[model samples]
Target: MTSPFASKLRTNYCPSDEEVAEIKALLVEPCLRLKGLDDKITALQKALDKLTQERDSLEAYVQAHTALISPSRRLPLDIIQEIFVACLPTHRNCVMDAREAPVLLGRLCSSWRAVSLSTPRLWASLHVVDVGRLAPVHDSSSRRLEERAALIPEVTRTWLGRSGQCPLSVSLYTFPFPSDPVAPTILETLIQVAPRWQHIQFTIPAAFLDTQFQLAAKDVPILKSIALHQYDPFQVPNLAWDRLEVLRGSNVTGVAISGCDLVLPRLPLRWTELTALSTLGSRDSPVSGERHISSQEAMELISKCPQLRTLSVLFEEHGLFAETEAHPIVHPLLQTFHCRGNVSTFTFLPGCLSLPELKEFTFLVHLPGSDAYMDDENGRPLVRFLAASSHLESLHIGISQFSSSFLQEILRSFPPTLQRLRINAMSKIMWGARLGSSLDDAILSVITPGLGDAAPCPCPALKELQIDRCTAISDSALLQFISARAATLKRIQVDFAREVELDIRPSLQPFIETGLDICITHVRPTRKVSAWEGLPHAERPLLD
Candidate 1:
């Protein structure tokens, strides 16, 4: 609407008292109209707020009733129990952790708790760690220790009680202390349920085996597997050895079980009935006093274990070939054999025994001296053994001080049926000399198949290849090997001791796109120089 003061409205003009009165009169009409519109907006906002509140209340009511018929709540009791069982860890026995199942399942709701409690399999296996004297004890702490000691037995009893008639797999460890009062109580409780034990492992001390530990042959009728740690072989509980299928000998924790700590011949195990055996305790850090069986003893153990399918043992370096050179023991059912020792262990492979049905083989030569593995002579026995095992699928060799020719001969002996090959050329050093690695480009070229259709290759069906500390293997040879076997190769892992100067990813990208798994790692280059970089005035040095 046009007004007389329209020109003055936007200008910086101060109005007189008479002009101001007239402007106020004109503004009164619009101000009353604006007040009326404000009243209408306030009423509409109140109605909208009420409608939103009602909608939210109705939606919440529907959701509340819908949850009553939720899929988990409506699931059958058996199905719910199965779901709970699936939540349990498959790798290890169940621990008393509320953060995990079956304890976690019990914390969800009353129905889930009931289902978890009623399921026998959920409670069939348990791993209990008794903190014993390791728990600090002083005044009030001493009382807490006694309370915890008393509570563990009761908790274990209740946990096992839920297992109805199901077989039990139990692992009990007592923190390397025998004087703890709680360990004996737990041991007593476990012995009471020995009939249902299918697998049992103990990492307790010798004192626990004295008067507290008692198990008759009749008590462990269903026990199939047993692992004894820290106890002397002589003091080990005399179980039903004939029925046992698996035996594992662990390291000496407290004291040497016997004079040599696990002399293979002295153990009271019925070797013929066993299917799997492992005596090398903690391969990364082998415990002191753990004895390695002689070559003769290893052969003797193999002959005794007719039904053995897997054997992992450490052998000594010295043995006479005249003992078993003529007649090699032939096993029909043995499949996997893992041996660790010095040069003699590899030598024993050919002279000792034959595994016709062998599928997997691992030989680890540790701490080879200057004279050991210097030539291909010791590796010839390994080639003979590999030739005899027609069904071998996996081969793992870890050694140091190996010559290139020795490793080449070993690689050539790999059977066509082999699918997994792992070679670890450990850093070689003897006395004051640093030895060179045998795993070089030449060795990789041997396995890399030719482009010719008729040309043969080692491990043609190889799916996995792992080479560690092969600082001599170059990027070109590694790529050639992978490209030649890309059709069957699924995983390739190569670790170099020296830093990789070239990036091999561009060449490997095509295979990676086709779902090939490749892992290539190398150490970082260090700013290191030779000890005697400068000579005596650029001539001969004073030091020898």
Candidate 2:
């Protein structure tokens, strides 16, 4: 193994001080050169930073310029249309103003204007609440009403035309006491579009339905719903259509006649096929001379309309169905029934009307000063009916006062599947000062579901509760209840509670943090009991 470099190899080498000094001298020259190289690196780093700043500044300017003609301006027509649809207002109150919703959306720019104009749904819902209030171009006070009436036709015609072939939902109201009679032209304009009407709600003057008036309901093949509200009692005219025919069953399924003036014989449409019906001022708002309808007449109406699914009425007299007590009026498909009137209205309901499939019940009754909700048997029908509705899910109660024991009993008997409960406690001359906070305390007890012996939590499936008016609940009890049910209770709306406004929120924060929707409003109670609490025999009460 004789290697090529073997002759030059050296062994056992060690550095001497003299030899190390010479090596150090050679390294000093290179170390000195390293300082200059570091300085050069710093200078280059500063230049790079400056270049980076300039590049960023230029890029920002480019982006700012590019955004002027951004891709959004180039969005597809269909996407822009969807955006316009999304911008439609989500409110039902009707008015025509330059600042509101769809109109506002149209006025943004030319492109938006075209898109809004092309959307039929945007213009299909028109609410002209009051003829006099509709702003007119002319400003003459003496001629204001006349001028507005004159322009009504033009405005309505244009609005309806914009809807193209869409079924119309029109709310047209005439002046209650017109200083000058409304022109015939306005009525003519509306009647012209009767064929396309699907939903029409009217609050017109009594004279508007005079014998001379005529409607082309014969052409309304798809007229499904119509509501007529009246404050003054007038005989609903014998409305007639030349010949009403439809491709299928009667398209008109919902009817609302406000006054008893609308006798069954006077009604023009098919009553047997109706799925929803409402009548107000039945005996509730009767003039001095004319208020008709006995328990017999009302019972007869109900007997004939076997298919009615939803019924909301205000009955002034009790025992509207007593004559039919022998044979109950059972509506197998009825799911929602709301009735409002004095305590007497539902007194005789138990023996007569039976709605087996009803799921939601609402009763707003007045409080008689001397009467008790439970002792007087005013709530018997309510309790009896709710006890029977095994599938009932929602309850809306607005009464003069909510007694603690009374509410507890109702909740205890509420359908086990109940999910939404609304308690609106309106004032009624103190009705003896409210058993203060007892009602809310009772509620806390019911919902809290006490120890090993007490019944299961009332409304165990309840996810929402709304309590408005009255001062039955204080902050302390509200917090305790919410904290206990925070896991299952999803939302709560408590309006006009002073104590809750002052102190409940801080305690509620823990529940809210975990996803509880809670609202507490502070409102000073105004004394309007005189307006709403008038006895049925007393002067006709006007709402406040």
Candidate 3:
């Protein structure tokens, strides 16, 4: 059949008007009919969409009912508890955040919240930052956040309450002094839980802690480890402190005190029971005319601490110990001793103590402008000390400024059994004479060409090596250092190797592939600021 909308045939040379009209005729009615069908199709699509939505709703309802009868609800509580324990904070996330671990577990069903809350260990670790230092505002317009002081205590209460009777590893820091109201409130709240505190770090003023020691003494049957700051060494109370026992017939086992007056005789610490003692001098602030500890007093403490495993002392000035040859206090179990101080202090330390088991020793001598490598008062004593500690496996020298001959002399005298060595050439406090610290050639010369005994490598059993801020060393020297010990080199970390002209990624790839963990951070050409340290909770890292 002929289509009606097709153009009509014209017969005449110039077609009549009627013929032209027929040719130009419109299909309006047919088009209108198709539009009606399109409208109908649109209505049907809306209906289909409505039906799909209803079907989806019904499917969701069916799944909900199915879930109610699911076998997962019958999972044993012990298994759920194990899963909850696994969800607790890990090392990478040392502080618990709201989206992680116990907090995340609590956000689930009621049963899960109950399991998380009941796990005492989950709540035992409380890491808090000082609230007072979070926002410092000195204007008269906005008063210091005195109102938020109550918030700290409330949170502390909730954590301690949830912890039940579990022993706590709490780092409680309140910055500044007793002036901050939040400091006192938080301290008061923590003291209420004194019996449960197993390991604690309190960096507040000594006044805040004075009463707590007595409170802790009464109820704390085993206060094993403590780190205190802003201590007044001479403030040791005259009362029969001996009666205040921290452990079961033992004093606190491990202790670290910083920024305190130096008076060993009046220390609240019990020297006899300590396994680790860290008496670090304060570099942050030094008030002249304040009482200081003599080398004689330091030796006395070491002599008394028979069970001490680790001892760290940083003396600011020369030690004027009265005796040149004090009776050598033999430390049978001493493993690590880190000493950082002026030349005279280190010169006197070795003669006072005999450590048979000393394994790691670090000596960082601050060289004054007047000092020389062979300073009559300083250099020879350290040599004598090195002779005494020939058994040491690890030795670190922060004082890199030395005459090469002087360093070679010391290296030659190193114990044959020495393994791990570090030369930190970038300590900020070390002044002058680091010109001879291009240590690669000197160090490599000591090692023979073969592995272990075949070569006379200073450290045969050396498993790990760390080189930081050694810009003078070439890539060849550093690589050769590792290659010499490839058989025993399990790990190597090169920090701030700026001057070296090798791409670490491609150059060290083979060593990495063979099970070496290599970390290289190229030196930044700018200075970096120190991280915040005022509060126990670093920068208010509280769980939100």
Candidate 4:
């Protein structure tokens, strides 16, 4: 049975004629055996292919039926609706996107769609934007766009109709296009349901505010809160001012109606009934001198409104000439006060106010120039105000700079109930000047417990600490501060002003594992340039 070519099996040697003839004679029986084996394998292969197709069909059939008996299919409608409701965006109104919740829930299946559509609360809130803003600019079909815009009225009407008489929460934004009648038509449709407007935000132009809102006053019977973004002189929509509890506006001062100048608070809103009022200026341009109140006017509102608990006002220097020293006015019911804007105007604010029940106070001072007008040392008036407010539980200070003595005195004045403290400062480079800021290791050491003998902790009940833009605090000081306060501190958030080379996570891992929330971020340092280097290069042409 041995073949002569066995020696050359693994070699490249060629066989001679006698050896080739011997190899061919030896392969005849094996060739016949190989052909018979191939036929047997072909039959088995066909059987395997048929069995695989049948198994795949059975698996698909079983999988299709298994979904019918899933546990999710037995979920109660109320429970399913609650789960669907939880998927909504809490911070903002729902948008018209299939990729997100309310809309996405409808596309799940027939049962889910029926539940979502039947739930009136799901369609009660909506954020509407003009189709022109969302349509692709590359699309050259104006007729199609016009038709799309024309459908807004119908779509809005249908959406609102699904609410089933529920109070509506809506935010509408429209760009200025007088030729397009869609915004006006949308406004009209919204006006028809004015009675159901529980909360709304409007960012329309001046013309719509003047024309449509004039007739909307009587219709908005249950409207309790409204925010306006219009800046032009327009009459107050004769809403039920007595019933309105909350009012908010941005850059909405110096409004004149029929040629009479009146500030926002000076408007004939039932000042006594308003529980909350915010006239925040736009942050895009902080010093625009648009929407702010003087210290005197703030005092007037505080003294006039007995039920007012929360007031946020931006202060500027334009209204400083009229105010002089006066006796402290006591507000018994005010709990939260947020005052920001120019620091110069904040000088007289603390001198004339006494908020005995104030629990939370935020003073974010924006330094417009190199100096604060408070000639008195260490913010004495402010310290006195904080000292008198024994119920203060939270205090937030954001200034361009802080003197060490002032910060220490304010901290010393904090009550034992103060549970939260946030200190933020802008870098000196932001103002293009070098100024003295006291947020350093020394100040942090002051707050760190057990560091000094017999030095009482400022806020013993403190549970949260947030510090930002204080570049002078080192890693060791921050770590020690967190370690000392680890028992009481539940949350710690710090944004280092410069790059941190050390990873402090290993040192604080034990505290984090024990349920302490921690977040640390670093700001990348950029190359510093001098005034001369920032000047235009000699090669570029100058502008006219």
In terms of TM-score, which candidate is strongest?
4
The regions of model 4 sitting more than 4 angstroms off are: 1-67, 130-155, 174-183, 232-262, 282-289, 318-325, 373-378, 427-432, 436-438, 452-454, 525-544
Q: Taking the tens digit of each residue's C-alpha lDDT, what string does model 3 give over 507-540?
A: 6788888998777677654543435445567664
Q: TM-score for candidate 4, please give it.
A: 0.73
Candidate 1, 1-544: lDDT as tens digits: 7788999988899999999999999989889999999999999999999999999999999999999988877888888878888988999899987999889989978877888889999999998878765555667977776677668888999999999999998988665433455767888889888888888776665456546555554667777777655443344444232322222222111111221345555555655677877775532222212457777777777788778888877777665455445587888888988887777667665666888999999987775653566357656667888877899999888747567776666777778899998988665876767664567676678888883232477778899999888777788788888888899899999988888877889999999999999999989776555555765555543542
Q: List the residue pairs that clash in candidate 2.
A: none
Q: Report the backbone clash tally of model 2.
A: 0
Whole-model lDDT for model 2 versus the true structure? Answer: 0.65
Cα lDDT tens digits for candidate 2, 131-239: 4544434668736666656576678778778888888777766554444444345556666777887887766654554532355446677889876655443444333
State which candidate has the highest lDDT: 1
TM-score-superior candidate, 1 or 4: 4
What total of clashing residue pairs does each candidate reach? 1, 0, 4, 0
Evaluated against the true structure, the overall lDDT of model 4 is 0.71
Instruction: Give the whole-model CA lDDT for all candidates, comma-separated.
Output: 0.73, 0.65, 0.64, 0.71
Residue 47 lDDT in candidate 2: 100
Please identify model 1 stretches exceeding 4 Å from their true place: 1-66, 130-155, 174-182, 231-259, 263-265, 282-289, 319-324, 367-371, 436-438, 451-454, 474-480, 495-500, 503-513, 519-544
